[model samples]
Target chain A: MATVEFVEATRVYPGADRPAVDAFELQIADGEFLVLVGPSGCGKSTALRMIAGLEPVDAGRIRIGERDVTDLPPKNRDIAMVFQNYALYPHLSVAGNLGFALKAAGVAKEERTRRIRATAALLDLEPYLDRKPRMLSGGQRQRVAMGRAIVREPQVFLMDEPLSNLDAKLRVSTRTQIASLQRRLGVTTAYVTHDQVEAMTMGDRVAVLREGQLCQVDTPLALYERPETVFVAGFIGSPAMNLIEAPLEDGCARFGETVIPLSRAAARAAADEGATAVTVGFRPEALELRGDGEGFAITVDLVEELGADAYLYGTAVAPAVSGRIDATPTVTVVARLAPKGVPRRGEKVRLRIRDDAFHVFSTKTGRRLPD
Target chain B: MTATPPTRCASLPVSGRRSRRRGHAATGWLYASPTALFVLLLFVLPLFLVLRMSGSDWPLLAGNQGINVPDNFHEAVSHRFFRDSVVFTVKYTVLTTVILLALSLGLAVLVQESTRWKGLLRTSFLVPSALGLASASLLFYVLYSPLAGPFADLMRSWGFTFLGTPEGALWSTIFLIVWRYAGFYMLLMLVGLQSIPDEVYEAARIDGASRWQTFVGITLPLLRPTLTLTTVLCVTGSLLAFDQFYILTKGGPDNSTITIVQLIYNVAFQGQNDLGVAAALSVITLLALVIINIAQIRAFSRRADD
Candidate 1:
């Protein structure tokens, strides 16, 4: 129940040219569930390991509560971690695995047994108290992993994709269990996962990382609505936001005949930044199908139907630009549609962007244009 | 109705599958027959011959005479040197097993932690295992010599005699065996240590376990299978100790280092050449080993169940 802070924490493997995690700076508040999310090799796990003190912090400092733990070992950090593989001691029974830390910390045998029994009850693992980890199902093993961390009553919890090994249905249920468990315990936690959906659903604040750098740290809705960079825009949401490179013309971004009107502030910001082109992003639910001659025509490539809603993945047809050879490549646009009137593949559909749902970023720097 | 047709089709392949399995089993036996034949000829035949010889009045120079039966067993049990050798074998087995397991486990942990020159150290440690036990024993014999060996001057300077006394001979032989086999046993324990996932150690570290606690709580328990294997090997190998003691001490300094195998060899070849009594001693040693091995296996399996 203490705040954890990473002040420019960086890690560079020996003989590697670049740091795995470079100048990482984040302050997790007390009782906050901060998730580090990115694709593989993005150093999200490295950042979490650094905070856990499992990884050496080659440079910079990390503080747990008020103590500098950069040079300290993991044992002195007073934190507990749930590994991705649920690394339960295979030889020990469930009770032994749960009470391992308490015993190591020199708790009396009686107290250790009491705490283990309490934790087993909380995890509904009473029946499995005498069973080995190999005998438990994946979901039960996952709870045991969580119980291992909870029994420590440490200052923070570090979970590295704890639910990744469970099946899909189990993963969903366990994700909620972990989230609510963290809330009930109110321990400051730093969780790392590559799955954006998991990060969006479980994190109080999601920090999206790319190429060993933090792209954006914000609430899930903020990240979905306004991603600071093109990477975060594409990485934060399911089915991802559609980004189109369009030319800036007449205070609007133009992609062939499809002219998306930008806010005055965005246009001014683009002009101020001296950006001749802009990358416009819109979510799948931000577009509506229209009649002919009213919107951009798209040739539907595929349709994914879910009970209530469907998504149309279509390649936008390049509209001829007058007196200009339109060299910009046509990009695919994904738009959500009502399940009732979903378009079939190879059919043409007209789509119009919602009034102010577009996110405009400069093409040169890939930074969001202020609006 | 639809399932009945599929069931009829499945039944049609049952005989074909069984014949194919029988053919596969035949090929497996065919592949294994050569080794099986070798074992029967080399091991089983000799075992039966020894058992038969133990019950007959067999001598080395003369052929087998009439049945001796319990006479050879009584002579072997009553022999003073034979009793002393059995006691000495038990002592050596217990001492060497304890020392070898402890030292090899320490060496394995040391090598596992080292990131630098690990291969060089491992190769250096395992190089002695490559030398035959007789060859290593002979080498150590020269090293233990007080007059013409490399360590002669050093031993003289330190006022120490390596194999001049019974305790010296015993420890010297134990040292030789440890040097020869510690690396091999270390490699076994190393495999067990490496197979433990790195995440387990990390979890223990996060659990605030000290290094010693980690070793006791995590490493020792997880390495139980390897420990059992190395313990059995060390005990059995030390119990059958003959080459090293024969080459180095020759039951030296008042016959204090006579192991059971050395006594059996003496009775069969050096003494009055009593092949019957030697065979009887061999049978007794084999029975003891079987009993010890069964007890060891039972102990390990019971612990595993718990």
Candidate 2:
């Protein structure tokens, strides 16, 4: 187990105008599995590489278990990494590939063989030891790569989208296998992926990055329930959290002529923070389709019905501010309903908002309003 | 003598010509005929001529005689010059092959590891390859001029004549050969290096492999195919070396630097102009090359299979 501390680590590629990873200050607890996730070009992979010492950290220090390893090479840091491509040595047999690192480290031949066999059996690769990487299937090759890393038994593990190359079905299975493996090993791991689902499901704490900056760092439930910023709120959930811009008046938020009663604490916090407009976000599941009133008049544009639940995609056409002050055309909301009673396209529906489920953020700053 | 020209020949439609598959086949053959003709005339015909000449003892100018078996095989086997040239060629081939492989592999590693100024170094390595061997020999001859040359003073300072003796000339040629051909091998090796994905190196690094260990275990093994190819080329080229020795040494002091090709040239064109013996030697050289290539191919394929 290792405590990885990135004390204001920054990575700037030479001659680039902006840093690829800006002062990323993070502390990963011993035995903690932290998943760094974001959209493409968000610098999550860069941060992981920096931690692995594959990429140099231009400014700041990195420590692994009380040892400052900022300037140390990957081998010196005693860390193991599994790459996206699996990166198994094509020429080496499965056994050879697994034992190569140990052999390189001058471990005895007998011990190397024993550890290789143990790791291979752990990965269910015992039958394939004598076979070369070319003879192995993709999934088997990935297991061998994992086996190679596991044999090292290093202080930390770094995995960069290791399952991204697998098929969808295989990805799901491998995801569970890798999470269970990490848990059993109890090694501090920094996993990098663009897939939010993998991050949410696997990470003890998911660190969301946006443009080289940490947007939010929390458990999946906390990040989903109490996103601290607009980016996080919009980024974390599937089908995305529907956000609408509306003016905030005394003790309430106004959408067209409809005035919804907000919590007194939230209004006071917004007022105290000098917020003029508010962005309201609600999950699709939290919204219920109703029949009448000036609630939220939405014409169903598209209806997607899964087996258990269905979603109604519609645009809210209300005369809201439609300028640079608030450019979005009213609002587009996705409502979740049971499969048996899903809405049809072109059907006008009124959405009954769950007030407690609604998340309010300041228009100017996009910071979450505490209730 | 025409039996009768068909009147339909004139009436044959242009559309009929367009539809004819024979015309397409004729066009395809027309494009291929030049290369086919050249190969037949230069390669196939020369091969037949060599085979015939190898079995004969046709002296220079025929000498009012017919072609017959000349006991050239006995002469080739017994002659001291033949033995010397064969030994010298084998030595040169083995020495050059090993030296070039080692140097080129090092250069390949350097080129692969380098970041800045790599283009400049690569171009410098390739510059010598562009020069013809004969021209390069002449250049070395000038550089080796004892009266007034850069190498002369340097050799003097180092207490050695770099081209004054057979050993000196052999080493000078080896140096020239390495300088000229290492870059070509480096290019091949660089392609091999770049083809190995960065992920592989990262994986090795994370697996507790030191840079040296990775180079030996991973890099070397992966580069074997390219290394094998370059080794074959180097060995074959060294075996067939002639122009530089002919220009720079002309068999040197005591005929010590004469390659088999140089000996063949001397037999056919110098003194007696013994074409029969030269042809026989050429046949032997061809057989040697074939045998060497077969051995190398077997080794290469066997490793690949393993």
Candidate 3:
């Protein structure tokens, strides 16, 4: 096991003005699984490639287990990678495929065979020892790929969206298997995927990237519950946390005519900066339907039912006077009520949001309001 | 079943009048006449004429005295040179096929390795293949011309020459053939290489296979079909090599560079103009090619099945 560190590593492709991964810094603790997640063209994969030595790092250094290996080739990095597609050698049997790395490293024949067999046994692939990759199903091929990495017993395992190819059901199952395997082996692993759910569920800590910049790195629950930036708050959850502009009014922030109390620090900062407005963000589950409340009344537009929880997508109803209501934004508010507590469509439900759970951000910078 | 009264039809009054139907059949044949005449006139007739001429004591000139063809075939086969030429052809075919495939595999890897400068390298390798075989042979002929320079020096400049002597000539011819065809095979192999998805390579890399391991275990297996086709083409083309030997050495200082086609040309046109023996020799060469092709197909298919 090794601690894989990317110390402000940067990669700029030739002829491109902007670096694909700009000043990227990440520290994966020994035996820790860190996932790098972003949208397509977001440079998450590029970051992984740089670590694997497939692509050169233009600036900074990478260290694995205290060894500076920024310029080392993949073979010399003591790392094995499992790709999105299971790249099993089609010509070789499962056993041969599994033993290839050891053979390349010049392990003796007897030792290589023993290691391959042990790894195959661990992966439940003894029955397929002689079958070529083409003969195996997709999931089986993925396992063989995993087995190949296992035999290497590398300092780090690099997986680039390894489960992205499987069907939805298989993807879930394989994700669990890989997670459990990583836990059992206790090897430092860096997994890259665009799926936030996979990153949240699989990683010990998740790093979010956007346009080649590291947005945030934190524990999954921390990122979801206490996001430091509006981007992180909006990106980390499904149905996304809702953000609304609230004008500073008397010691409270006013949303249309309704006023919600703000912390002294927030109010003082707003007054000191002469800030007129702040953005308020709240998760769907934090809002409850109240028939008669001081909160803004919203008309239900659509509902998404997910068995256990349902989401109410709607817009805030206009006040008695409409000329001053310049923003008519539709907010998708999700409520995790019991399955029996769904409200009818078109109902005007007053909302009561948890004050402590509400996140207030600077309207100018979108930075979260400090306590 | 009650028979209905037959209705008068404009096309045929009686559907089953045998004589009228026979006449209609004759008209159908007449309507299809052009295509039938074309096949017979252009394809079958020529083939028949060749076969007949090959078997008979024919001459290049109509009134020239000709040898009996059976005697010609017997005489052609009885010669030590004919046997030696057949052996030489087989050896050259096998050697050229192996070397060409190896060279093509290497070129395919080099070109497929990167997209940067890939277009430039691919064009350079393929330019030689685009040159006609006869043209390439003539080019080599000039380069190998005694007045040009020492052959050894030229060989060393290229790293090594398979061409040095008669044996060297055989290897040199193979070298030329390999050079002429490597790019063509590389194109085939490039297609094969590109068809393999990138995910597979990533899987191999992650699985801990080094570059060499990945090539042997994944790339080569997937390239088998392309390899088979390229190998067969190189083999057949090398076996029928005539232009290079004819232009380069003109059957050589000791007749050491003579191929089967050269021997056949000598038999038919050079000395006695024995058309009968040359025809017999052509028939033998065609049969040999047919047999070899069948054998190659069988061997490849058997390996595929295994």
Interface RMSDs of all predictions? 0.9, 1.2, 2.7
- What overall lDDT goes with each candidate model? 0.91, 0.85, 0.80
True contacts kept of each: 0.93, 0.90, 0.56
Q: Which candidate do you rate higher for TM-score, 1 or 2?
A: 1
Docking class of 2: medium
How well is each residue in B1-306 modelled by candidate 2, as lDDT tens digits? 254455556457655876687789899999999999999999999998887776777677763144566577667667679888999999999999999888888887897779797888889988888998888888887887776777778777777776678888899889888877888888888888888888888888777787788898888888878878887888898999998888878888678998999988888889868777788899899999999988997898688667
Q: Any runs in candidate 2 off by more than 4 Å, and if so which? A: A256-258, A272-275, A325-330, B1-31, B63-74, B151-160
Best by DockQ: 1
- The worst-scoring run of ten residues by lDDT in candidate 2 chain A lies at A318-327
Report chain B TM per candidate: 0.90, 0.87, 0.79
Q: Which stretches of candidate 1 lie over 4 Å from their true place?
A: A272-274, A318-328, B1-28, B153-160
DockQ of each: 0.78, 0.66, 0.40
Q: Mind giving the per-residue lDDT tens digits that candidate 1 earns over B1-306?
A: 878998999998998999999999999999999999999999999999999989999999997997978999999999889879988999999999998889999999989999897888899999999999889989999989999899899999999889989999999989998899999999999999998999999888888889998999899989988888888888899899999999998998899999999999999999679999999999999999999999998999899889
Better of 2 and 3 by lDDT: 2
Which whole-number lDDT from 0 to 100 does residue B149 have in model 1?
92
What C-alpha lDDT, on a 0 to 100 scale, does residue A142 get in candidate 2? 88
State residue A133's C-alpha deviation in candidate 3, in Å: 1.3
Q: Of 2 and 3, which scores higher on TM-score?
A: 2
Candidate 1 CAPRI-style tier: medium
RMSD of each: 3.3, 5.4, 6.3
